[model samples]
Target: MAIYHFEAKMISRGTGRSVVAAAAYASCSKIYNDYDGMMHDYTRKHGCVYSEIFLPSNAPPEWQDRTELWNAVEAAEKAKDSRLARELIVALPVEIGLDEWKAILKDFISKQCVNKGMCADVSIHDTDGHNPHAHILLTMRPIDDKGKWQAKTQKEYLCKRGDEERGFTAAEFKTAQADGWEKQYQYKVDKKKLYMTPTEAEQQGYERVSKNPKSTRYGRQNPICAEWNSEEQVLRWRKAWEGVTNKALEQNSIDARVDCRSFKECGIDEQPTIHEGVSAHIIEQRGGVSERCEMNRQIKADNALLLEIKKQIKKLSAIVVDKVKKTVLDFANTLENLRNRYIFNRYEITQNENISTELKQYNTTIDVTVQRYNGIVQQLDNKITELKKMKAEQKHLNPIHIFRHKELTEHIDKTEKEIKKLQNLKSAFLDKMSCKSEKDIPQY
Candidate 1:
């Protein structure tokens, strides 16, 4: 089966990471970081199926080279704790060939990252021939139309209106100040000095730029919110990958699809088996005992038991439906016959000279009808009891069984409805018999 696994992390300087080192490890090649003047080499590293760099349309064409691309990233980022790159690790479908995998990944990166101005360094790995996956290193900063990297943040000046501060451009700030509205500055060097212009302060060796206190610390060009770093975005990216991979699989006519949902979200009640990587798989294949192998064995057993329970519930549902149909038919026939026999006896008493024999026959017919109704009612009760027992048993099994065998629930509902109808009919018959006896009694 094609499994879903997409993970994301950052190659950050705060965590002691370099984009060049990350690129070297993922692509299994050598690269040099010009910022630190350090060389990172993994040229002897193995198991890299494919490695390439994808850039935006406006980016420099020379950035197609991995060394040049990542070296530029290192050179652009000057802070010691700068976030150099964003990395995504995704599991590729092993059922697809290498070419298909490459096509799918290329389309995904082109649409998702490159179009959004992030250069993607994609590397496919197939170590041990079983775990095929891809690593994508993405740039965090936006690129300009001139193919130059833009600062992640830019400064904006704010102006104070009537008791409220509002953001303004440099020209708007100059106009507002000239319009005689009080302006606020974040850095006030001297309390006694009323105000000093930025140029005067700079000329006097005060190298600080006074900012509006209400102005934002930094403004970002990209519209994406900072909340994109949250778990919700991770789930969204995973789902997106699942959709892309499934589409590719469908295009290739593969019967399998991947889901980024959890077992519960997928409406499955079974415990998911743990992922045993290539090493564990090989060890288990060699008849070795491992925790993952044992867990898998138990999961298989539980699944088998769940299947058996489903079969039993289905069989029981069929039996109950069949029995109810037959019983209702028989009871309806008996009630019709009893009603006809009573009407005949009443006519015989009104027209014939001897009424005792007719009366006796009527009584016998009524008794037989009552006995048949009782027998059918008992059988129905027994069927319901058995069904209830089955339902109770199902409660001990997986909750997934309820979702899998919806017909079983429907049958139970139908049986209960039939029981209610029969009981109502029985009551009506008894009421008719009582009314007839009251009218047949001789006057005192």
Candidate 2:
């Protein structure tokens, strides 16, 4: 089965990573970093089946070269802790052969990344062929219409206008400068540092000291770049990839479908498994299964059991909630038809005995139905009891069967609620029947 996996990360200088090196490692090639005089060589690394670079319309045509593109990205950011690039690691459907991987990935990346104006370098790896996946290296900054790297953040200064202090970018401040807006600076006042405008400092008998103006933390991120960095955008990208991959899987006549959401988000009650990363993959590739793989297998087995339990509950719901309820309502309507005829004084004395006989028959039928529903409830109760007993015995064991016990508890609670709903619905039908007891008003 093809599983869903999409992870977003940054190639950041703060983490001591260079985008140029990341590009080389992902593409399985040799590239030299112009920023730090380091050569990243992954020429002999295994399992890179394909690599390609995609560029936007406004981007330089020469940026199609992976090394040149990333080196330019490194050169653009002049900070020690700069975020170099955005990277997405996504799993490809293994059922699709290597021959068709490129077209699917090209459509996916072009729609999700490159069209958003980020230069994307895509690389697919399938060393063991079963774990086929791709690494998407994307530039952080956007290229302008002139093919130059746009500023990730423009300088914004804090300006004072009357009692209001607001921030303006370099371009906005140009016009804002004529509107009684003065830049604020740190002023020395009675051995304390105070931030005020030059006029305010003079009026307060203070001296301006600091030449550097205050700015917002993280400055002002480029709108496009900031949108790309948002959680919603990442989620959108994941969903987009899932849609594309599932389409390919369907085209190949594969039986499996993938979802991008977590188990909880997908409304699944099963616990999710842990990610078995590089070391585990290496072990499995060498024909030795790792402990994590064993754990995942166990998890899959537990999930299958939980799904079976859910299916049984769904069947019960279909019977009690839909079929049984609808039949009861139909019976109620039929009883109401007779009552309506009697209510409007349309029944003659000759028909009174016949109507009474019919009412008695309806009472007997309702009783039988109520009894049948009671039986169903009893059966559900018995199942819950068995589950609880199993849960208790498992809890007493050394390992305690943690997952099963928890699911069983939830199952028990859900069943009890369903039983409550069944009881209430039965009472509602009995309320409309009007002669629920045999001892009182039975021969009416």
Candidate 3:
């Protein structure tokens, strides 16, 4: 099985539209989002499973930089974009079983996509079948008519903290954050059930959420650590996230590979020729030639069989004729013998003065011989007539009599022409898919 992995990013300003288009063209990959910002995220490679789906540009038209994006998101809380702030999530079904994987993603973001001003575009990759995945870039800010932002899942964001240097001592840390005051961070069995508001912590007589398991007895960290900028942490988080996602998929009996990448995993650098678009066009021509070659192979076998059958039929006909000829000769011998016996019987009858027993016996024998000879002649004639008819039919059906080897030769010629045409077509497709420059990478 090939790896069921996909890479994606939130489009940023730096994503050049031309580059994105070029990538799509070279990889035969699909393009989902046309917005400038979303394109940026893809080229910069800020996408992965954890941050799989990304937010669209929330920055003002003139605004630039991540800070502007944050500001735009903030302003959208009060007043949203008039034009539906469109964001999309694109994916390729290559490794993840395009059909089911896309379905899962659609269901996961169904509510998000259906919301006013929000839309999701899901399409199959029609390229060389290298990275058959999806590209999803959704909006971070809400639309004007959707009402004020209620900030769903925003609470999860607030629980995070700065790096370890900014981290306060155990006592001070508990006092610093609201959850710390509630002892949510403390390692205690029952403390997990307790809730702590920032002000409530000071009034309730709880100290900083103790990190020591002996104190609060609940040692739990926030799910999304506040720091995503650290490269090492990001790598570990990505690995863990992928492992968990893959494990879950396995548990549910879902596949973990894509068809496109399987060939590469098996060391097939060449892409399948039956793909859609230009690649398909090229292969069709080439395949036509290959098909003709295979057809010609069958033609050769058929011709050979026909020739062999004709030869066997001829040999059988000759044997039948020889047997009929011998029957004719036997009929002649019987007729001559009967004539001679009849003559002898007549003489004996003439010479007999008393009862001619010998003559009578001879006469009876001659009659039987004549009758038997007649029957043999009739049967031979019937067989000869039948053999002649069979020979005529065989000649009519035989290739040598009808079209002969010429017909088969003509067929081969026509097929060869067709094969030539297909070869030309294959060549055309290859030219189209060929890499033109150093950056225009070829995808199998």
Candidate 4:
């Protein structure tokens, strides 16, 4: 079966992470970082079936090498806390072959990254047969037409013209300076610090305390790079992954499809289960249980019980007999509080299709049994009504006939009472499951 998973994060120097080491691990090879003068090697690390570097048209051809590409990224950033790379990991559908997925991934990266002037270093991993995913490391900076690394951001100086203040870059300042725009600086006026033009401050007899002109904090980011780092872009990538994977599944004639929407977004109240990675899955398969697996199991069981209760409630409206209604009311009276019916446990909801299907079948069987019991009760009631009419109409019935009728009616009523008790027991079983307790369940 194919699964849907798309995770994205950043490798930043602010978090003490290195893109060189990240690239080495993803490619399953050795690479040296020129910026830190350190060699990052992951030759011993397993499960990187494929790895490659993709460059923009104007990017240097030498950057096709992982070491060269990532080293250039490291060398370009002068800040100790610069964002080094964008990392994304997506699960590959089993319906598609490794080579086919690679081609699909290449198309995604080419259109979304390389064509937009960013380089991509991608690797596919399948150490465990169950979980196959790809890792992508993308360059944070864009390349110019001359194949030179462009600045991620540029300084925008604050200037005032008349009473209006605006930020302008170096090129824009040249034109704006001609229109009587003056750079603003921090000035000491009496005992307070104020921002004013040099000429204005001098005329007011204020001292220019700071040499630095006021500018926007962190400067103005390049528009393209800014859009790439926005939250909206990540959402787009997630949706795109879902679309491509579904297309592949459909082409392969596989009925199973994946969704990017979360449980809440889909309006489902069931809690989703957490991903139990390769290690947790292996432990459970080797005669041992993992904490994640156990939590998932519990969540599945609770969800199953909740579904059963919902179905039983829906079927209740179909039953109109007075005996059925009275039995349900009596069962409801047994519970002191209805708030204990739901249990909220940790972990996401697992996709236990088999368990869900079997529960539905079991509920269907119970409905059939209840319907049969109702039919028998209805027949007994009709028989008793006929017997009373015959007893009143007859002048003097045979003594044997009167005795036999009395005995037969008594047996019919007894059978009806037994059937009503069974129906009551079924309702109690549903309540027991909903509360996740054995207290209300009958031993019989």
Candidate with the greatest lDDT versus the true structure: 2
Give all TM-scores, in the order shown. 0.56, 0.65, 0.23, 0.71
Poorly placed runs, candidate 4 (over 4 Å)? 205-207, 278-295, 323-444
1-444: candidate 3 lDDT, tens digit per residue? 434343334433333223234333332344433433443233333223222222223313332233243334434433222222222323333444544554556553453343323323333343355545444433433433333332321212113233211323354555666644222233223455343333444665566555432232223232222222224543443344345445446655777623323456667533333213334345457653233233343445444544554564455456656587775565456556655655665454445523445655765765565454445445545555554555555556656555554554555555555545554544444344463432443322
RMSD of 3: 39.6
Better of 2 and 3 by lDDT: 2
What local distance difference test score does each model get? Answer: 0.74, 0.81, 0.41, 0.80
Question: Which candidate, 1 or 2, would have the higher TM-score against the true structure?
Answer: 2
Each prediction's number of clashing residue pairs: 0, 0, 36, 5
In model 2, residue pairs whose N, Cα or C atoms come closer than 3 Å (at least 3 residues apart or on different chains), thus clashing, are: none
Better of 1 and 2 by lDDT: 2
What is the number of residue pairs that collide in model 3?
Answer: 36
Worst 10 residues of 1 by lDDT: 435-444
Write model 1 residue lDDT over 1-444, tens digit each, in one string. 687888798889999989999999999998887888888999898999899888889999999998889889888988999989889999999888899899989988887777767899999999776789999998887788899987765555555555565666555567777775444443446553323345445556543444543456664334442434557767767877988999988998999999988899989977687766667777778876455565576566656655655564455556666487775565556556655654665454444424545765887877776665567567668767867865776566676776645766776777778777767765665565563432442321
Give candidate 2 regions above 4 Å deviation: 283-444
Model 1 scores a C-alpha lDDT of: 0.74
Model 2 residue 404 CA deviation in Å: 84
Give the alpha carbon lDDT tens digit for every residue of 1-444 in model 2.
798999899999999999999999999999999999999999999999999999999998898888789999999999999999999998988788876788888988898888999899999999997789999998888888999998888777889999998999988888999998988899998888988888888887887788988777757778998898899999899889889889999999999999988889988788899988989878889886566675676667657655665565565555755487775665566546645644443234335546656866997987776666557557657766775775676567555567876776687677667757766665554565564642333332
Q: Quick one: RMSD of model 1? A: 31.0
